[model samples]
Target: MNIDKNSVVTLHYEMYDANNQLIDKTEEPIAYLHGGYDGIFPLVEEALQGKAKGDVVEVTLTPDDAFGEQDPEMIRIEPLDVFPVEVEVGMMFEADDPETGDVIIYRITDVADGKAVVDGNHPLAGMRLRFKATVDDVRAATQEELAHGHVHGEHGHHH
Candidate 1:
């Protein structure tokens, strides 16, 4: 079946960096609701439009199209006391942002000089991404899946 609105689209894909270095590859096919459910990247979903099983697609995404440009303002250095005990690099924590009234996840990037350096930007932000995928399947989404705005069951989310 061809990918269409409310369809469950599955793809076996690989991601690469601008330098041609392999970044990530799917070991199992990843499935997402097609036609603007926001489950997949806009650029990729656009490319997959009307695609059928066994079809191949290749696309490149800029910072804006992908994770977005890195925001330096999201970085903050706070006193060690602000964090939980035994803080270490690569740990993630959620902190309330007063400016936006939103909880932002911060990753501990450094711990030094009685301070913790945290960054809120996604790790892949500011990097160009290249993707290649083979369409594996496309089937009409069930009413429940449509209502939930995502795919459900078999390689997807469950109740």
Candidate 2:
């Protein structure tokens, strides 16, 4: 069936960096609730609209459309003692954003001189991305799936 509002769409996608280097790809077909549910990128959803099984779509996303530009303000240096235990580079911790009270994940990028440098920006932030996807299936979403704003069942969310 053609993809449309409240449809459950299944597809596999490959993501590449601006250099054409492969960044990520789905090993299995994943499903999402279509129609501006935020389950998939808006631009990609737009491209998939009215498409049917076996249709392919390719989209290039700027930093803003993708992970977004890296924010220097998200980086912070804190005393080593502030950490609960020995911290190493690449470790991740969750903390509340002082300004918004939203949870933020901070990754330790450096450890030295009794301090740890943590960055909250997504690793892929500030880079252009190319997404190519092939539609594998499309069907009407179940009432529960639509109400939850996501897909559920095989390759979908489990309650």
Candidate 3:
């Protein structure tokens, strides 16, 4: 079957940045909800539509289609006391949203004598991405899988 909404797709993919540096890869199949939910990037889901098993595709997505453009507001400076004493540059910590209690990942970019600069933007937020993918299998998703809004099997549910 071709990949479509609610279809279960299994594929191996290599992801690269604009610099052509490898970011990630999957030797094992990566499965996800096709178009039923936004489990994967919309650009990728759109590209896989109507494609069947064994098809290979190369797709490129801009920042807007991927993680999105970097927002300057996501960068903040705070008192060093806000972080643990041992926090160092490049360390990541969760900063909770006071109202929603949602935890956002923030990376410590700079730590000076009495202040720290934390950035909440995703590492690849402003970069274009390239994906080289080979579709391995495509099948109708089970009702349970659809109910959960993700694909489940080898690598676990992809949310």
Candidate 4:
């Protein structure tokens, strides 16, 4: 079946940075609701439209289309007391951007005496991306899945 609005799509993908260095790859197939459900990248969704099982797609995404450009303001050094003692590099937490009041995830980049460096920009931000995917399955989305704006079952959310 063709991937369309309300369709659940299963696919395996590998992502590479602009320099052609592999950054991420799906170990197992992942499923996402097709259409404008925000379940996947808009560009990727557009590329997959009308595709069916076994179809392959390769697309390049600019920083703006993927994770957005990195913002220097998103990096800050906070007082060490603000984070748990166990905090270490790579630990992440949700925080509100003090300037924009928007919620963002902050990853600990450094921990030092009385200070901790956190960055709100996504790790892949500012880099162009290339995606190569092979469609594995396409099926009509369940009513529950549509209502939740996501896919269900294997490679999907549970609970």
Measured by lDDT, the strongest candidate is 2
Choose 2 or 4, whichever is better by lDDT.
2
Model 1 residue 103 CA deviation in Å: 2.8
Residue-by-residue lDDT tens digits, candidate 1, 91-113? 99888899988998899999999
Which residue pairs in model 1 clash with each other? none
For candidate 3, list the clashing residue pairs, or say none: none
Model 4's TM-score against the true structure: 0.89
CA error at residue 100 for candidate 2, angstroms: 1.6
TM-score-wise, the better of 2 and 3 is 2
- Measured on C-alpha atoms, candidate 2 has an lDDT of 0.95
19-41 per-residue lDDT for model 3 (tens digits): 99999899688888788487778
User: What is the Cα-based TM-score of model 2?
Assistant: 0.95
TM-score of 3: 0.89
Tell me the lDDT of model 3 at 77. 94
Model 3, which residues run further than 4 Å from truth?
99-101
Clashes of each: 0, 0, 0, 0
lDDT order, best first, reads 2, 4, 1, 3
Error at 26, model 1, angstroms: 1.6
